[model samples]
Target: MPKTTETTLEINLSALTHNYSYLKSKLESNTNFLAVVKAFAYGSDSVAVAKHLEALGVDYFAVAYTSEGFVLREAGIKTPILVLHPQPTNFKTLIDHCLEPSIYSFKVLDEFISTASHCKQQDYPIHLKFNTGLNRLGFRASDCNNIVEKLKATAAVKAKSIFSHLAASEDLNEKEFTLHQISTFRAVAKNLESLIGYKPWLHMCNTSGVIHYPEAHFDMVRCGIGLYGFGNSANEDQNLNPVASLKSVISQIHKIKPNETVGYNRAFMAEGHQKTATIPIGHADGISRQYGNKQGFVFIKGLKAPIIGNVCMDMIMVDVTNIECSEGDEVIIFDGIHKASTLAESANTISYEILTAISQRVKRKFLK
Candidate 1:
């Protein structure tokens, strides 16, 4: 494909493969690696990421919802996909596409079983999600009795895996809490196993869990941010190579005198005479409004260019007085050299948010 007109997201398949291999090395041979490709593979092209992972022999793929799984299925991804959050309304479509749903609550379980049985489906694959301690979604430990009863009644729905989300696996200070969650999940999984007469695959660790708590890496590990190269901790962060780099070219330049105002609402007033460059990217392109008025910056010709004013829908101006760049010259938003983590720090967020928020409008180029 030709180079796009504005900004672009370059996905390095080689880095992805390396990260996968590295994470796999950290686990036991029999342990499965579930790549979380939801939100366009964390905002970097889910198809490309999933395809590369499938080729590399990833055991499974996971998404937050049923529609994301459909995208992978339609893209010719034959690997099994786990829908972390399944809605009752899309049970039919999910079953039709051979996608597995993660049933969290008793209500969810009852509804999914009812829907599947009504469709005359048998041994329909599904994952049971236990809340553990996140308190977001999933079955509470108190709901265990009801869950056991539900499982015995719903023979058509096969529980293929039991999983939970970790709330703070990266914070060493939260080690005790993390262990508590794991222990609780283990009990829940064991109880469900007893009722079902068999143990489904158990997974609880996300990227941080893979690094911080190896003992919790039971049957599988669902890696999201780690696979994309931003480990949640500093030690882990130092080890992974970021795979996605964002780049945009200068569309125009202007000289601003002292006291001059720039961008929407005149958010930035020049403190002194300065040169500014406009890049064809904005909130619509995933550069959030939080980066407006010198709060965030981008790298241009090896120098940092602070954002000048309100981030417009289609454009953002950066103070380029000190940077040696001209119109059409490329600037780095986030890359191996600049680092997505650094950009995220400037934006007062994490790399996960920045990476996942990158709009699909930006062209993606994959390089091995």
Candidate 2:
């Protein structure tokens, strides 16, 4: 493969397919798989990623906002898209685009009911989100009666699914808590069904939830990080291939004498003579400032180069003194060899943040 002169995010579609297959294999044949393509397909390419997954026959697609679904719909993507956080104001647009909204609260439910009715639409498929334990979104279990009342009052909207988020599905320590959440979600789903005279598709498992709680795989499973190559567990991570690789070229190299400083605010003061390589990527490109000043390292010639000084808007300097590297040499910020999970750990974050933080300004190269 030829090295690119600029920083690029390389997305491997084959690896993504492999991950999809692996995760799908974990599910029962009747269970539907929803590929979470929000946040630009976790900062890769939403159109590209969703298109490939669509081709693979994913049962559903999810995005954080309606605009994301709009992009896919415009691109001729025929898959059903679930808008996780649908604002009341975008109800009309969502309806027009054939996008389903996850109605998590009574206010949203009532508002959407009114909107759908005013639009004279009937049986518009809407998902009901219950707040079992995540508490971040979704209606409370106590709000189930009110939800049923509102839906019964309006024929404009129909419940398509009842789902909730798992707070810590990846942590073994939270196994008890996860089970409790599942139980609570099940009760909520049952209560809503009895009140409404029907049971919607019940889903509560995310990527880790699907891996750790196989029994919780209800009607469908929503997979986000796992599709882009992360399993949230050592054993599962080994089974999945990371789909994205961040690479750049060393633009310049400098030899700094003792006491010389580098980068903004002179954050890095050399103790002895040192060599550094500056790459054209920084916080603006999704490499957070927290990874600067010895906090993180990049791979050069299969060697580790610690980052030195502050990470600038478009530049980052790394200590490459011990490494046999020169300008124009390819550098790996995070790839299969230099896992994003490791880089994220150094920044006290998760791989999802690292992957999604990659800015849209950086060119994305897709490999099939």
Candidate 3:
């Protein structure tokens, strides 16, 4: 990858391929793999990522909203797309785009069925999401019979898959709880199958679940963060490569005197003569305010430059008193060697939050 002339998020499809292959290596040959591309593929480029994954023979794609699935369809993605949290208002549009919805509640299910029927749809694919343990979404085990009955009575929508979200699959300490969620999902699926006389393909594992719980890799597994690189643990992270590299060039260099402060609120008072380099990336670019006042650092000339003072909307000044560098030199916020997980740790956050919080305004350059 060339040095970014501007604040840019360079996406490496080759890295993505490596991560995908690594995650897939853990699964059975027959197990389907679903790539979650929601939130702009975790603040990269969804279209580029999805197109690459589709070409790589991905089994399915998932997004948080129907509009995201529609975007994929518009991009000529032929693979099946599941709208993980679809709305009733968009049911007709979802059908128009041929996107599947994860019907989590009775209200959503009933509304989707009505919309599907109104649209004169027959056997439109839909997923049943059960609230096994992740109380965020999905139906309860007790609702299985009702769900099965609803499916039996509706020709408008067909159950393509039954799935649930794993709340703590990444934490080995919660292994018992995760196993219980899996078992509950299994019981619900079996009971639903018995009532419906057919089995919809089952899935409940997220990226962490895929890594820690092979036995719970029901019929499919959803790989989100793993697909973009961080594996939820240091040991697993070593096996994966980060796909996004946030880079910028030093916009300006400042020379400060003793007792002189930097940025708004005069946050950083120079103890002595110090050099500060301003990079054209800040909270607007997803480098949050939490990273200000020496909380975060950037790599310049292979050396660490601590961020000084408050983070501006479009700029941040970093202390470069020791590093010998010049204007136009490359600065690495995070890359394959220094992963986003590392930077995320500095701000007391997780890699997912850091990765997905990246603003869309930043230029995206892809390496295929």
Candidate 4:
């Protein structure tokens, strides 16, 4: 048996595979599935998630940095890893590990080319990123000339894939805007292809785009949050199984008198006589401090327990007055039943924030 901790992060691999297959079914057979495993696989466990996705025959894996890609390489992951935000400082390490970098800006492209040449590397695969509309990291669509010029001039670097990110693929209200972005990307891609005399694998849609605009399934689709089984909108199908569950044991229970205060700075005041359960989890464990003051809740004995006071670095007090729970009983912060969405909503955030915000200090337990 695996060693038990005060708090447990349960990763359901079967659910992951199911989610992958679910997204795969939505795309054409020719469309490659690229799994985004950055942020430690959305703060679950990148190595495990990447391994599972690799075993499930995912065509590619993407991470935010070279270090994340290195982790997969060390784990013997043979799948191509695209570094979404590759830095020049890590260019050597990235080349050493056979990791591909996404050339977002001209500066990054030059740095990568220079580094690869210094290392005596030849024709290293690299993905080109177009900004489209995200306003984040990516080359501007109008700047295709510069990209094409560089690629044509440089024989040391090779274009593996060309891609862009959708800003709001899930919002139907933004459908018109999304379409414009898609059109722009398509035009830029066509121009680049014509200029380069070759068609690099083109991908643009994210998880939300894959569901809402299936036609945008270009050459590949990147799925991140969806892989953990949460749709972009509640209106979409809810068949995707949630892959992660968080459970923490109540370490202490106390009966507070009316008008008593709880936690640091007395953020939560008792309405009446209440029983409070202190759990061994707090912001330090990924639960945010914004969830303090009874705004956030957890499941105890199938009942809602309002979190009281400030979510400290190491613990959180819950108003468990009516719940039939004990010191050693498990409390569900987020699971299939509670839904990570519910928690994020309570904290005025999205499920992505809640799931990815989970701290690294907590233990991860994988369930196949």
Best by lDDT: 2
- lDDT for residue 267 in candidate 4, whole number 0-100: 77
lDDT winner between 3 and 4, please give it.
Answer: 3
* Model 2 error, position 210 (Å): 0.7
Record all residue pairs in model 3 with backbone atoms less than 3 Å apart, i.e. clashing.
none
Cα deviation in Å at residue 86, candidate 3?
A: 0.5
Work out the TM-score per prediction. Answer: 0.97, 0.99, 0.99, 0.97
Candidate 2 local distance difference test against the native: 0.93
**lDDT, candidate 2, residue 196?**
96
Kindly list the per-residue Cα lDDT of model 2 for residues 1-368, writing each as its tens digit.
87778999999999999999999999999999999999999989999999899999999999999999999999999999999999998999999999999998778888998889999999999999888888799888888887888888888999999999999999999999999999999999998899999879989899999999999999999999999899998788899999999999999999999999999999999999999999999999999999999998899999999999999999999999999888999999999768999998997988999899999999999888
Query: For residues 230-326, what per-residue lDDT tens digits would candidate 3 score against the true structure?
Result: 8999999999989999999999999999999999999999999999999999998999999999888899999999899999999999999999999
C-alpha RMSD between model 3 and the true structure: 0.9
Candidate 1 per-residue lDDT over residues 1-368, each given as its tens digit: 44435688999999998889888889999999999999999999999899999999999999988999999999999999999888889999999999999998777888899889998888898888888888899888777677777777866888789889999999989999999999999888888787768889999999889988999999999999999998887778778889999999999999999999998898889899999999988999889999887778998888999998899998999999987778988888988778888888887998988899898889888888
- What residue runs in model 1 are displaced by over 4 Å at the alpha carbon? 1-5
Worst lDDT 10-window in candidate 3: 1-10
Q: CA lDDT of 49 in candidate 4?
A: 94
Give per-residue CA lDDT, model 4, range 1-368, as digits (tens).
44334799999999998899888999888999999999999979999999888888999999999999999999999999999988899999999999999999889999888888888878899999998888998888788888889887777898998999999999989999999999999998999999889989999989999999887899999999999989877754387888999998899999999889998887778888999999999888988899988789999888999898999999999998898878888889998878999889998899999899888889889998
lDDT winner between 2 and 4, please give it.
Answer: 2
How many times do residue backbones clash in model 3?
0
Q: Give the TM-score of candidate 1.
A: 0.97
lDDT of each: 0.89, 0.93, 0.93, 0.90
